[model samples]
Target chain A: MPKVGMEPIRRAALVQATIDEIGASGSLDVTVSQIAKRAGMSSALAHHYFGGKEQIFLAAMRHTLAVYAAEVRGALGMADSPRTRIEAIVRAGFGTTNFRREVVSAWLNFYVLAQTSGEAGRLLNVYQRRLHANLLYNLRPLVGDKAEEVAQRIGGLIDGIYLREALGTKTTNGSKATAMVLAALDLELGQGK
Target chain B: MPKVGMEPIRRAALVQATIDEIGASGSLDVTVSQIAKRAGMSSALAHHYFGGKEQIFLAAMRHTLAVYAAEVRGALGMADSPRTRIEAIVRAGFGTTNFRREVVSAWLNFYVLAQTSGEAGRLLNVYQRRLHANLLYNLRPLVGDKAEEVAQRIGGLIDGIYLREALGTKTTNGSKATAMVLAALDLELGQGK
Candidate 1:
């Protein structure tokens, strides 16, 4: 029973170690031995949980995404207004300020990795679609009849913004920038700017 | 020197051959020899014009982006209203049906590569920034006091759309889905849908 209780913690520790390595070294290609050394666990333990590098890598990616999805949902649910909700989602997307820069960089790096592999690529796409779907679901009511087209435009701009910000442009802080994007959507739909 | 000419056609032909190779075999790492063979030129002749693999790749990318950028600018310019311009830009971003799937797929693959290395990465960011800046400039007359914020938001959505679309999910393309995103923005801004 005690050994069973240790399993999740050990796996979690492995994932955390992987995240750390990626953040520090700007890559996720560090070996299980590297992760095990960092986690202070025997390499056998790493193998026991993950079976291989692919499994461990999957765990790390899934863990990061799960946290992201939960935070994004929480952000959307936190505020009453759509604008505030969108801002919250954007802020949540940035994760925490202390770990923000490295976390974002790591996420982007993993995303590119996900894009390369067929199986992992499919998984990442599903997760992202759901994330955007949730945003669209929250946004549908306010946009009325033109909601679909409006969403297309908004979605485009959001993608455009992340690429810019991720590349060191830093157009504005998360909250303010979200507000501006929302406002433009209104203007684009023939609503007030 | 005058026979083959310093004309756009030679470069265009070389770019076409490179594009075909890139699409058939994933990755932009096509060799100068490979490209020269496809372009019906001797290896030395190819080197004479393009120098090396990186240079050839950059030239091909530039050629591709130039085509895309022109289409986008034309689409936007045709519209008198900012709202209409937004619509045109979105359509242009998705690209046309002719090479839509191939081109978009290639672009997404390149995007991942650009995240890692080479002139392609640099060009990717530069072209995006230039486009965003241009959008901001055009958006100024429409947004007025809130111009900057609107620009950033617009930029984000634009980037977001491509990321979502490239993931090849119906969610990024659906009406009810996209509307929700726009609605969320509208409600956040306290504007009517």
Candidate 2:
């Protein structure tokens, strides 16, 4: 029997293990047993907590999104102006915590998983919408009526940088990634003016 | 016994079938048998032709790259200036045939596969390198010393648009996608001046 208060710790362990396992394999082709082994728990215990691999993956996805959301929120809080807010959001995206190889790999695989899993797909949509809304809100003060379009480009560029990084085509350089995006933001803002 | 001229035709069919299957399922979690059935052939024939799913997938990736290369080549031949050449390349990325949902889906899965398969990774590298070279070649006359950075931004934008499209968050609007990338190009060129 498990002790009280152990469930949350075990679930967190399992979720982190899921991310690490997916990162190592570079895909969602991992089994519950592998994740369980990595978490240092029995497959049965992992199953008892998360039901199966899909649930475990979803939990991991949720955790990744939560971390990202917190980063964005923290950055936004520190931003004093609209343009600065935009910079903050872009910087948060390429921040060390979210831009690690393992996290990026998990993100790419999650995008793939969203195709077949309804829950995963819904979670992805939520993330996309929030990101878009955040950009749009900040962009309106800078780009005026073209805020939506400019927001889309910035968002796309951020996602694009992540995808490129995931392929290992370029070394994972967060500052470089941040510069590419900020340059795009600069161009968009300049054109809008 | 098989006919002598039938090999190329069968291989082409299998490649197309493979793209369709991945697109329909939205992942590389597909089986050779499913692809074979989709091609209206037996599993043994698919196995005999490609040996396994990975080869079939690699072949499909090759076909996608070939088609994209041909489109860019055809477009570049018609371009009369360096700036127009850049336009030609960007437009070719969002061209009607290449921008179809199935092809885009295949491209995304291929990125995932590249992480695990050496051949897939090599093919992807070749595509990325060629794209960068083509963009750098044209961007030189316009941006001078900044050509490489400009080219990287443009390439990343094109890819970013495709990644966004794959999630089905927005309709697969090639014209809109093309416009966003071209706008980025325009901004980059304007800045370089």
Candidate 3:
């Protein structure tokens, strides 16, 4: 439940804080008290804004999907031709941007939780499948007859980079991971890293 | 502390039982009394096998890693060409072997526990980093000049699929993923379901 007057701003702020909390570390269960303290508001106010932690988590995760969808759309703007657009779309997953750190952190944390045994994991899996379907639909023309396969491949590639960065155990950086996949596609990308 | 009759086989048996217990879902901590019950032996027999659950867990995790490492090596043997070997090696992480299932479950559980802020998490992180680094070293020859970049790509791909499959949500089988990747590599693969 939201106060009718402050709904948009309050909701945005809650989701933003959620992303910041998860991004600063990993997405653990952030308590009502912790979120309230961080927001400079009462726990009751936080609850009123987002209902509860689950609602807040879902909002933050969905907010990230929206952000990336917009970026992918914008990146699609970088080139008029389909081949170049596909390259831009692939690069979008790896390029340094303001959202890069937070996105990668959120991305890794998302998949980590997705591996667990429960509702949270199932929700994440559903979201990813739907998201990839949309991406495949978007890239269908660019990939010609093999759009579905290409979409999964690209999703896996983006997922692979997010996994590496989140695991923080891999020896190479985001750019390196991006370059190899691009090279494999023979998409004529310059050495990014 | 082991009893007088403690033997390596007995110790291995105890660890194997612990692995199944953990795999099937249960609290890992046990009195030697419980291990004896699980093993259908006298309490003294459990005492003879090993010191306790901690030892059992350590050995289980080590066994998991060793098994995965061996599977990886075997998968790499199935192909003659560099590209073929790389594809096979990637499949190793998503293989159909019994070892793949057990090792994935063990590693996934360990990884989740590792995310918590504690000694267990740190230990898992350090050990996995070493293993991932060693895995990358094996890909050096196939990658040639772009070894580091290629390693990052391939390593991330392998772990990404493992993470998804371990969850048993996104990927129920590896064939589709394998085909998608093989297609991306320009290798002709059988149709995916």
Candidate 4:
């Protein structure tokens, strides 16, 4: 029999391993065996846990999203104003843990996966809706009626920066990306006034 | 001889077929036979022309980019001012031909392909550079020293809008997408003044 209460630990290791593997490959063209090896476990065990490669990838993304949500919640908790709250949300997006090469690669691949996978599509919709809601919620106080439009632009900018960074065409680090979005925020606020 | 002046025509059909195939499936997980059959040609002949699926996809993107460049050039020909030139560029991106659901899907897949394919990466880099150059050239008179930064933000915004639209999270059509980018352009210009 297996050790009791070990499922969560093994699952966490597999999720991290999946992200590392996808990052190294820069695409979804990875194998279950490779991920299993990276996690220091057997393929059979990995399959027993996650069912298949797709599930493993989905699980990794879930973990990544959860981490990102935690970061945003933590940052938002300390923000004193509506503008700062927006800033906190933008910074959380480009935070170190969320903006790593592997994490970004996973995001790009996930976007692609959402194209064909229904489950992925639903998950992505949830993320997009949550992001839009968060931006709109804070932006309401500042932009008032223009909050929806401004939120869409900010959300689009964040996603766009993430997409560009994943391509690695430019050496835009987290802080640089954060600054760019913040500048956009300033422009929106200025225009609204 | 097989036929006179048929090479270019055959290649065009194959490229269009590739785009349609990728768009229909929404990923690169497609087969050469499927593309060939859709193009109304045999897989053997398709291989004779493009060598493989990857080459066929590269050709499809080349055609897409060429069409986009032509659209931009055509629009710029009638543009009366620098701001109008910027508007022309933004409008061309979200124009009907370039912003079709199939074409956007192809673009998203191509971005994913760039991660693992050197040629795709180079092609994407060329597209990115040309976009930056075009934006900077026109933005110079308007923003002066801040042209590069403004251009970068505009480029990122364009990309972000495309990414969001591809996911189909919101019902943002081409005109709507174009309007969003133009608004960002306006904000940047206003802030630079």
The candidate scoring highest on TM-score is: 2
TM-score of each: 0.68, 0.96, 0.68, 0.96
Q: Kindly provide the TM-score of model 2 when superposed on the true structure, using C-alpha atoms.
A: 0.96
**For model 1, what is the error of residue B68's alpha carbon versus the real structure, in angstroms, after optimal superposition?**
2.4
lDDT by residue (tens digit), candidate 2, B1-193: 6668877888999999999999999999899989999998998999998988789999999999999999999999999899999999988999998998878888999999999999999999999999999999999999899898888888888888898888887995898898888877878878421
Clashing pairs in 2: none
lDDT of each: 0.63, 0.90, 0.59, 0.89
Where in model 1 is the C-alpha error above 4 Å? A1-14, A17-51, A73-90, A97-99, A109-111, A114-116, A140-156, A181-192, B1-53, B72-91, B97-99, B171-193
lDDT, residue A102, model 4: 77
lDDT winner between 1 and 2, please give it.
2
**CAPRI grade, predicted model 3:** acceptable
lDDT of 3 at A144: 61
For this target, which candidate reaches the highest lDDT against the unseen true structure? 2
Give the clashing pairs for model 4.
none
- lDDT accuracy of residue A145 in candidate 2: 90
Give the clashing pairs for model 3: none
Candidate 1, residues B74-109: lDDT per residue as tens digits?
A: 887789876567556656665553134445555655
